[model samples]
Target: MKPSYPLMLTALFGLFALTGCGVVAPGLAAAPPTPVPKTHHSAAKQKPRTPSPVTVPRPTSGNELGVVPILEYHMIGPTEGRWQRTPQGLYQDLTWLYDHGFALVTMQQYESGDMNLPAGKHPAVLTFDDGDYSQFEWNSAHVPLPTSAVGVLEAFQKAHPDFPVTATFYLNNHPFGVDSVAKMQWLVAHGFELGNHTYTHADMSSLDASGIEKEIGEEQAYIEQSVPGYVPVSFALPYGGLPQDPTDRTAVLNGSYQGISWHFLGVALVGANPAPSPYSKTFSVSIPRIQVVDPSLVASSTRYYILSGYEAQFLQDPSMLYTSDGSPKWISFPQNLSAQLNPAYSSRANPEQ
Candidate 1:
């Protein structure tokens, strides 16, 4: 059953008791709405572009087998409600995460085992799904609105340079309510990753094999065409619905549509829990994500409060959270957890005493 939006807001208000933690009262002022540009669906195809290689720093001291919080978000608007976070709330979320020794990493980085961070720092993946206009909007002057999600992230990074600006935006057709190819290019060029979220946000559980291919493939083709060589490597299941049939499910991991084949390294789910480290034996292509919603706003059956839930658990037992070993070449962890390391990464494992 879906949670009530109004009730969720009321619960958040009561949870924070109107604290100045960016939870504004209803009807708070926001930037005036700007005219949305028409999106382009160009049929022209171009060769796939490769992203520049990045250097991973030396390994720091921490458990590489710990869990990573792949935070999932939907709407970013003025009012905080079900599956929605306000601009202020978004800022506050980053503040809380930064203060808690968390740094931002892209979904690709997490999946490829390239997450290198400072000693004692942990990695967190910020994912925004169903790209709504509120998540990203450009003003008449061609600048991201201060209240937009991207704007908020840029601002936070500028203020806290140590907390790098990186995230994965899982987009559907007409992403962020705009079909402009330039917008898509802008995201990729700015170091943000664009992940496939299906073409129509279809419920895969009800769709057959062909339907799944079309949904996933069309979106991939669109992104690749839009960005001219940029292929999405990560996928987020729409509605968190996976194909019921085992074979159909496998198609999502690797499939082709109209000859435009795709291979996803990580498939994100809507589960409200931290994801296992990439180097863990338990790790697989299917990754779990914790919804960044307030626990009070959700029903008891759907408790996914980031602060009071998983974050609290990490605070209590830091070992449970994936702390970077600083170097990308070595997967380091306590010797006790040696058994948890995936054999594929055994050559790079550095189990310490």
Candidate 2:
């Protein structure tokens, strides 16, 4: 058979464009991005858990930790760079998540007991690290460019409508490579979160207690100065490093420097599998993050390992994954994994019996 040259060329062009090849579709102008709603930061819906008329079945064996996959991304413009996701790839991710009933939530919400997703929808967290310029920047029209990460996310939300438009951005000193104050304030005003990634992206493990405090304190100070009243409760470790001393964990969790207080309920790691629910006994300071990268860039074993591993179970046997039935007071999961859940949040009924 003769080679389909046109089809082959189109596919090649798409593949190239995904890696920052700078290809624009001929004669296609992007529509202006939808204006983000100025909802109060605390407006997250929380429904009271009441007794259900119908009994919800308990899973015999499956994802029981109410595993909320927290995915991490570094750059958004190119697929070729390590830990970077192309614009098309990001859209594909949102589409897959929306189609599969995944509701987006902030790290703060995931750490809290007040989850309010639509019935039967699972929660996931989208986190961007290093605050790359490609994540969010204003164009000549002073509007968010559809090509940036924020722009792509807004466009995706508009197209899907039900997908949550929330994300947590962990920042270094040079936030998003734009006007730090404007972008940070914009994020807070528009339902997005700004988190500390250390002032200079310092490796915590190498730093002494004073150094670690300085690293964290300086970044927290900048954020407070830039966006008053926006206290950050989530932290992403620089280079995914933890301090050598056990006491350092407490410092990261709750510490004060130069009269400014800082605390975090969730501290993210550099790369690994998805995190179990915050209510899980296994959950801790070392929250793992799945890097958003093209498969070719990572080892075959690590490529989309978490998503591919849990996605099928989430769709067909959702009870295997962490899901809320309008109740945040008690932990929900399979009987087999009962031992893994935090006793504080586990159901009173003994799963062992």
Per-model TM-score, in order, reads 0.82, 0.76
lDDT of 1 by residue, 1-353 (tens): 12245434533443343222422212211112111123545623555567666455435368999999988778887887677888898898899889998988999888877776877878999998877778888877657888889999988988998888888999888876664577788888899999999988777878988999999999999999899989998998776566777667767877998989998878787655677788887677777677777666776644534545776677789889988776757788988999998787787777884
Give the range of the ten consecutive residues with the poorest summed lDDT in model 1: 27-36
lDDT of 2 at 30: 19
Assess candidate 2 and give its lDDT.
0.67
Residue-wise C-alpha lDDT for candidate 2, range 1-353, written one tens digit per residue:
11134423432333233223432221111111111234765545656566566355443322336777777776776544554678898888888888877788887777653556654677888998888888887776657778788899889888877676789999888687767688888889989988888888777778877888888888899999999888888898765556777666566767888987886766776555656666666556556665566666645544435345456556776665556544433344556776776666544322422
Q: What is the C-alpha lDDT of each candidate?
A: 0.76, 0.67
Clashes of 1: 10
